[model samples]
Target: MIITKYRFLILSIMILFSVKGQSQDKFKGYFEPAIDLSYQVNPKYGLSFGVENRNVIYSDKNMQYTVKQIDLSHFSEYQWHSKYAFGLGVQYRIEHAFDVDEESELRFQEQIVYTPERSGFETDHRVRIEQRLYASVTKHRFRYQLGYTIPLAQKQANEPYLKFDTESLLEIAKTQKPELEQRLGVGLGWFVSSKTTLQFGVEYQLENYTQQLNHELFLLAELGIEL
Candidate 1:
């Protein structure tokens, strides 16, 4: 059964890539790498810190293989119930820090996540609100994401898993009209040890879909560790 499920997942991913490849000329490619560390303070509370770096690998209008931004983030979560959790987070972003046109930003976030009891696959529903502060402007955004995790092997230290997620975002700023974006992602993850996980993924983003559509593709690598 697990093998069949894995085959289906692979076929679906291939189909998606094939369909999207038709418009590859219009898409920009980026690479993102990140690492996260989390500590469980108690049964109900947890804290996490993460850093992510993004670079443009292929783009028609922008310089290729250039540093785009780096983000430093921290979050705290409280599990209020078995199925629900609340979180607050802050992030500092350094935009084009390697170039002369460097800019900085601060963002604050509040979020809630719901995870029902596992039934074959685990699922998460998350809602988040963000306030972004730049040197000259402030913006507000709302986002919601649905994610699924499918175990490909029996529970063990070296288990493998598949993940799929979709997220919708709306941004509102005083200087510009509102914009809507959507993101779709698929990933494979491995439990390297009891406290370590590694993941590789691809995410496609449709930016400003309600207006002039911009297509972006991101290749992602992430490492997570629990303390």
Candidate 2:
């Protein structure tokens, strides 16, 4: 039964990716790599820190692989109930980090997450609001995401899992009109150890979909550790 469910999920994700790929004319590709560390403060509180970097791998205008940005983030979460949690996060981003003319950005975020108990699969619903501050402009964004995790093997060491998520974001700024973006992601993960996990994934993004559509794809790799 578990194997059948896993295959079905994979098939569905492939079909969706195929349809989206055919519908878009052009898209840019990026490679995103990140590492995250989490610490449990108590039963109801936790903290996490992460570093992520993005590189442009394929683009019509710029074909050469280029460093885009590096982000350092910290977040704190409070579990109010067994199935509900609230979080606050902050990020510092260095755009064109390897170049001389780099720019800096600061962002603050607030979020809530809900995870209901399930037998076979795990699900998450998240809502987040962010305030991004740059030198010239500030933007506010709202986002909601639905995510699923399916374990392929029985709960044990070195288990494998599949993850899928869809997110919608709305960005508002004073200088430009509001823009809507949609993201879809599919990933394969492994519990490398009791406190370590590794994941590889691909994500498709559509930016400014409400107006002029811009498509982007990201190849993702992440390592997560709990301490």
Candidate 3:
């Protein structure tokens, strides 16, 4: 129907604007235009994929949408009516930010791997990020994500040549063994119709390292069209 098409068009516009006007203070960068598509694999299952320009227009490269982690989700839902429902899913995230500042602000570059062993993991290393950012706002709503990763898992390498005696040394050797960066986030979504949603969020990361600390904050925008 004509009404349905109009709604989709509006939802798309919301995706563009939400990224710019969230808190109205700390978010003054990046409106990276992106294209997103989704498919219904089964009666109740769905999948989605998206791509965005690295240099988002109106965004600061120093404080823009650079990624550190990601999450793919499988969810189950309950519908109270066409207008409202709730769902749950599990997610995991790749770690970003290697260290933090004395003030606890995230320093982006320090997040790069250092040390001999760590350099290998950092060299052209990629994020196999997995995370579950929940959605329940049948109406316009927002949610925040908070998480942390910490010191050595206390494990030894399977490699024979690099046999280390103590847990501390092995962990220290691999700069990858960073104390967890605390993850903080908040986003808003508007339900344009029964199956279309527009979302936007801002996230701040904190890291602690041997030398000093680092800080970085990002504002992210997303568009989802449910099948």
Candidate 4:
């Protein structure tokens, strides 16, 4: 059963890659660096903060990078291992372009995560609600992410693993004309220390607003630190 499921996931990802390869013009490269810090206050509660810097790479060969966006967020969470977790947070974001003043955004968010036990794969489901505070418009968004983590080596923190995930986003506040976005990603992770882990991956994102069918590809790096 595990082998079958693994094959299915691989096949699906391959299909997506094949389709993306056919539309080369629509594909753009994104480079992101993100870091997260968390401190456990107790067994069931914690405070976390993170920042991510994103850049658009117009020329991969030349490595021409442009400032795209930066996100900063802080949150508090209550969670138990192999169980459920809840969080509340706020985020401040800045968006930039080649020739425009930076736009700022604020967001209040709430989330819940649940992990279910399995023999070969570890799976988790996360649902998040957000209130977007923009300069002109206010929007409410909801996101659901399904994630799978595969253990490759030792069970200790300083080990290696593989992760795959898919997430979908929906605009719920302005129900009249809803917008949507979807993402698929695969990453490899290494626990550098007991309190630190690093992940690198490629993500394919599809946007709903464009008439021409195109996708954005992102090279992602994530670091987590525990205190």
Q: Which one wins on lDDT?
A: 2
Runs in model 2 with CA error above 4 Å? 1-26, 61-63, 96-102
In candidate 2, where is summed lDDT lowest over 10 consecutive residues? 1-10
Worst 10 residues of 4 by lDDT: 206-215
Q: What is the model-wide C-alpha lDDT for candidate 2?
A: 0.90
lDDT of 4 by residue, 47-87 (tens): 98999998888553356778788899999998856489999
Which stretches of candidate 1 lie above 4 Å from their native place?
1-26, 61-63, 99-102
What are the per-model C-alpha RMSD values against the true structure?
Answer: 2.7, 2.5, 21.8, 3.0
lDDT minimum window of 10 residues, candidate 1: 1-10
The true-versus-predicted C-alpha distance at residue 27 of model 1, in Å, is 2.0
How do the residues 1-227 of candidate 2 rate in per-residue lDDT, one tens digit apiece? 75565565567557756866787556789999999999999999999999999999999857779888999999999999999999999999988457657658899999999999987899999999999998888999999999989888866779999898889999999999999998888899999998999999999888898888887889999999999
Q: Count the backbone clashes (under 3 Å) in each candidate.
A: 0, 0, 24, 0
Q: For candidate 3, lDDT tens digit of each residue in 50-166? A: 544323223342443443233333444343333333344332322323212211111111011111223211111111222222221111112222111111222433111111110
Judged by TM-score relative to the true structure, which candidate is superior, 1 or 3?
1
lDDT of 1 by residue, 39-155 (tens): 999999999999999999988856589888999999999999999999999999988466657658899999999999998899999999999998889999999998889888866
Ranking by lDDT: 2, 1, 4, 3
